[model samples]
Target chain A: MTKKRLTPPLTDADIENLEIGDQVLITGTIYTARDAAHKRLVELLDEGKELPVDLKGQIIYYVGPTPAKPGQVIGSAGPTTSYRMDPYAPKLLAIGLKAMIGKGSRSQEVKDAMKKYKGCYLAAVGGAAALIAKSIKKAEVIAYPELGPEAIRKLEVEDFPAIVVNDCKGGDLYEEGVKKYQK
Target chain B: MREISVEKITRTVRDLCIEAACDLPQDVENLLRQAKEREESQFGRYSLEKIIENVELARQDTVPMCQDTGLAVIFVEIGQDVYIAGGNLVDAINEGVRQGYTDGYLRKSVVEDPVFNRKNTGDNTPAVIHTEIVPGDKLKIMVLPKGAGSENMGALKMLKPADGLKGVKEFVLKTVAEAGGNPCPPIVVGVGIGGTMEKATLLAKKALARKAGEHHPDPKYKELELELLEKINKLGIGPQGFGGRVTALAVHIESYPTHIATLPVAVNLNCHAARHKEAIL
Candidate 1:
């Protein structure tokens, strides 16, 4: 498979060019958020309050990284299950969230939002945190530090690998791959 | 009576926690290597290779393999003649967990309350301990750091006696199929049959500690395990649920006697990490 190198903030063209099952190596800046942080982000949106970080054309990684030991840029950091973020994803997508990086299948509603908004969803290898963390060059908590590991972090990554699970055209690797292999 | 100091117990528990988080058990690592060789999908094979690489990195660097260091679940078997001195056994175990999470730089995953307060416990103490009393003068301790990705997908069912084996198999298959990629495949499916509701659940969790690809000793249950494993792999959930021929490394079933009128079944899924370690004193 030919690997594509992407540097966010990704444009609509960047996401639309992707297809399910395409391998990608992402660089540049991405933000991290999990369940607690997502709840707060959505709550802020609901109340017409300002969000701590901008979502336009930005990628979000669903992860809660372990605390870094001395002399490390970051600890073992990998994707969490994506379904838990399904409830909040469409709202972010509506507000110009360009892509999501995590493991597992997204809900149909979230996929529909990706198609409607020209966004994409990617899958990082779960349980491969140490290998994944090696791609991250820098990390700093930017919002909701009170949430601890669930806080939003701005990360500078180089060649961070993931697979395109859902594309703007509504292709789903999980469903298609299962159909191809299932007996 | 054999006297063991509480300090010894605490120290052992702390060490086990640190060790288990950073290292993949040999059995699990071997299974993943085999899965990588057997995986049919290109993406699945790649995922397996990365997982294997991650394990090596974690071990070499003395860092956790995954960010979710998990809630500490300790299984202890105490001999009738062994005595724990200097402190209460439970408190000593919690103290060990506190030190392990703090010293190891593991994540503090536990919240003080499930619903209301939702405050981080900070130290990841008060492990979920399961204790059994046995014959000799030895203390056996096993530490399992269970991540929540797969744990959240566990299921239990109280079936009628008429449901029988066919219904049990169907339920197991359905649970895995519905879980799809959510539990972080490839997963280890632990099925507990018979017993009461809670016992069935505990048995399912206990089944996870068995060596990867190991089956039940009984011939009948062993056959059932193999059959279930075959069905699961056929689902094509693959590694990380992206789809392939290796959805699960093994299917383990543990069962006990049940009442004539009742049938209880539980299913627990463990992700590819399946981290655990043991020591006997």
Candidate 2:
């Protein structure tokens, strides 16, 4: 299948154009965060403090990459299950987060927020970390180094592949796909 | 009595950890390739292809196949005539895990406590070790780096004898269906029937260490395994749960005799990664 190429700093139009199950090849900058980082980011928001990184028009990848070996930009990095971030996702979406890249299904609250906020959720193939890493040209920890692998990192990616699992219109590929194929 | 140095055990454990992270065992790789070929859905085929490629890339670069390098789970079979010299076996295993996580650049995912502290353990030490005593003089060790995505999807049920086989099948199906896209399919379903609650869970985990597509020794259980595998794949959860004919690469069942009044069942899932490695000393 042909994949639509998407670059970060996505506009509302970009998100609206996506449909559940559409293949995408994402290019440009994305931020990395997982369970621990999400907790801290939400905490900062609750405290009425500035976030370490801006959420506006930015995409956050739910991943905790293995340590990079010598001479490598990053190690195998795949999407973790996305539901763990459901609690914090809507809050980020409210702040203008345009999209998220992760694996698995999102909760109803997060899906509703995506529809209301003109955001989308994309799924990178889980257990395909080495292939995903090939798309990342550079990575540097931008915050919470103490969180180790969970630290927030700025990544420059090229042709990073994902599928639109939840679209702004409230379509869910997971549910739709399973229904289509279930015997 | 045969004496084995703690130093040797530690070093071997360390090597196994690195190997388990970097290499997708041939059994798993072969199963994935077959699944890729067998998958009917276009998206499912695409996911499997990517998984296969990831395995190749991880092996070539000596990097982990997936970032969640997992909690180090060690299984050791100690011979009755053998003795571990120089240190306690548990400490030696933990030390090995420390060295391996650091040296291999694998992620340290363990938290010190489940609820209160929730602090990172730093080195992925304090491995969940299971020991069994056998009759030989050799020591056998197996390391399974279990990622959390699938691990968190595990389920257990204590049922009355009246529940029977029908209850077991329904429970397994419900667990996988509820899991949906979350457990990182196509998953290996490890089912444990009988035993006490904890024993059933352990048996389910041990089931994962078996070769994919291999059936239980008993003809009865093997037939049940095939039946369950068919039912699960028919669910169309697919690769990464996108929907396809290849939702499960295998269904493994390990059972133990149970009390007259009790029937306990546990399900443990391993993602497509399904990583494990072993050594004999």
Candidate 3:
């Protein structure tokens, strides 16, 4: 019932207080990576090698954007399905990745990871590529350019819209929202 | 026999690929409107509205409706009397996919192999093509840009004849309920009943290509579709599975005659952004 727009991401307490289905407009630095990049990062971790980017207090967007057209810094950037990244999320969270942005429900393992690591999961509007892209003030490829669209990129966003799907307090919006609406 | 130029098929197929990728089909647009009106939750209604807006932005601005541009799915109905002059029909379709994905600036998602190496193909070639020979001079082509999310959730089951319609419906509703928000709610449910295992799956996928809200020709199946839609919406999965009364925009069932003791069912889901385009040549 309560709604708030976060132009800049709030504290973990702010995220935990959000009810299921509460709309939020988030502004902050979010990193982009897809299946390929996640796999590589996890592998690097397994080898005890340093990662290309720092995970502390960072948000990882599950996206692979199209080539930027003309003058745009990024192309139709939107969230991919979250489940594909379920396997690696716990490890990333353990490493200090605080927030994950994607669409759809995360598995219990990911939710458990969020609770254990004091991390969160945010759901961006799925399929709203152009609208979502407008939020990005800056975007540049940071690593794995060989993966092209699937590469990891750094994006600075302002008022990027999202909803908290899972929070560190063991709350899950997708589950609660469904139960509330069950007819 | 009628001779058809390979060049024409190649070009037309490419057009279909791009069209299906960039634009949301009109029938689907209307169905989403209806679902929005019927949805009970404010969040579900809002989500549906966002989807409608996304389609317009994608169409007017020439951007992809979804980031997953999807795997190329080609459905070809070749006339028995027609002869393709220059090359193989399948090859022509694949070439069209390559050109369309590259030209449209869509994502190349397919891997060169499934098991190991799993290297990206760069250009999305080798479309999943289903070809059928029918009585006609013209070839009909339908392109469905099927995203991996819903496609990954697709399932096929073989049941004893005793299970019947109720069993089929339960399985479908369970799939949607279990999927929750994963496939992206306000989804279109495509059900294929009968046929062999893989054939049933193919038929289910093809069923999703139909215009949203349209029902099966058979009265019994149409009734089943309506019932399934009601049950799915009642699950309260809502838009993006955040709870709502309009979890499914529509349910479409396609069935075939089956063996005496066997019944088979396949469910293929298409998210709100169901992208499909067709052409005849």
Candidate 4:
């Protein structure tokens, strides 16, 4: 339950320090990607092609935000479920993806990769879109503009709040948390 | 002996789409509040509190409660004595969805095709419209924007009639447990029992459209709903499965008669955001 602050271009020590259930407020730049974009990124990687953006020591937020209104920075922008991206996560982690911000439990494969690759998985409040969007000061599609919501966007965030779900040490709040409260 | 224009329906549907996405209904809000008060885990309480804050923000501003503004699913009950004027009902509804998503700045989550070409329709169009012919001279339209986080976790199973009520309870619990945090905890579970396979799934969807925390009119069903709610909360999935009590806000069930050999059950999970709005014309 301890609260921490993070500014990305995170280091190995940063990933190793986060534990399950600790609250962290993130600031600085994070990239956004949905499943479709993940597919393309991994496909590019498989073919030994360079990525559109540098992901080393960066966070990728799994979201497909609603379009912003006339005077807004972004629309309702909450985390989507993480499991769908599990197939691509290990590959991204292998390539130095430091952390992921999403909702829901991820597969064991993703968790194992996190442990091995010094990555972490964070969970934002799933349906708290407007609240989450408040932290995002700027967003622009860095890649795949044709993908609409699924488009990869570079975001400048300020105090974006999330909790560590899967840390580098193989801690999973979804498992331990439920076990503690299960009747 | 009454006529309603498709243009009017379109306008109503469009407004409903925006309203449903931005506003968390009172009953649902109350349930979330209750869950927050009851939640023991620090993480669970924090999540519930944050969700409530998000709900208020959505209500006060022109913002959606969730970014996954979801597939536009419409339910219409048209009176037999009513004449529809101007245009095709389905097309009008889709047009409404298109206008609402565009004007409202909601995400267009619909895909043109499920397979082979997984492409977004870009307008959140061709809504899943379910129509029913009723007895009165009025038409009712209900719009629910179903997010895939919970919708993807839905399951339907055809059990042998011999499995009985015990079987139904077990299957429903299994579905929820297997779903884990994927559907988002503090969910609203809609259980549909009996009828054909598709009918059961449809019934489950209809059950979700029912007011959250409202009991079935039938005493037997109401008791079952209560029982299921208690059991689900006991599972300790909590809010967001960060874990503690209050895994679900409600368990609303609808049932219909089925074939002698079949006892089909479907579970439709709705996240805490569960957005729906309606109008009577």
The two-chain DockQ for each candidate, comma-separated, is: 0.88, 0.87, 0.76, 0.91
lDDT score of model 4?
Answer: 0.93
**Per-residue C-alpha lDDT of model 1 across residues B1-281, encoded as one tens digit per residue:** 99998999999999999999999999999999999999999989999999999999999998999998999999999999999999989999999999998999998899989999777888897699999999999999999999999999999999999999998999999999999998888899999999999999999988998888898999999999999999999998899988899999989999999999899999999999998899998
TM-score of chain B of each: 0.99, 0.99, 0.98, 0.99
In model 3, pairs of residues that clash are none
**Candidate 4: residue A96 lDDT (0-100):** 96
Worst 10 residues of 4 chain A by lDDT: A14-23
List the candidates' TM-scores in order: 0.99, 0.99, 0.96, 0.99
User: Per-residue CA lDDT of candidate 4, range A16-113, in tens?
Assistant: 88888889999999999989999999999999999998899999999999999998988889999999999999999999999999999999999999
Cα miss at B142, model 1 (Å)? 0.9
Any idea what lDDT model 1 has?
A: 0.93
Which has the higher DockQ value, candidate number 1 or candidate number 3? 1
Where is the poorest 10-residue window by lDDT in model 4 chain B? B176-185
- What local lDDT does model 2 show for residue B232? 95
lDDT for each residue of candidate 4 in B1-281, tens digit (9 for 90 to 100): 89899999999999999999999889899999988888999989999999999999998997999999999999999999989999889988999999999999999998888987778888999899899999999999999999999999999999998999999999999999888888878999999998999999999999999999998889999999999999988888889988889899999999999998999999999999978888999
| Candidate 2 residue-wise lDDT, A4-60, digit = tens | 989889999999889888899989999999899999999999999999999899999
True contacts kept of 2: 0.80
Candidate 3 or 4, higher TM-score?
4
TM-score of chain B of 3: 0.98
TM-score of 1: 0.99
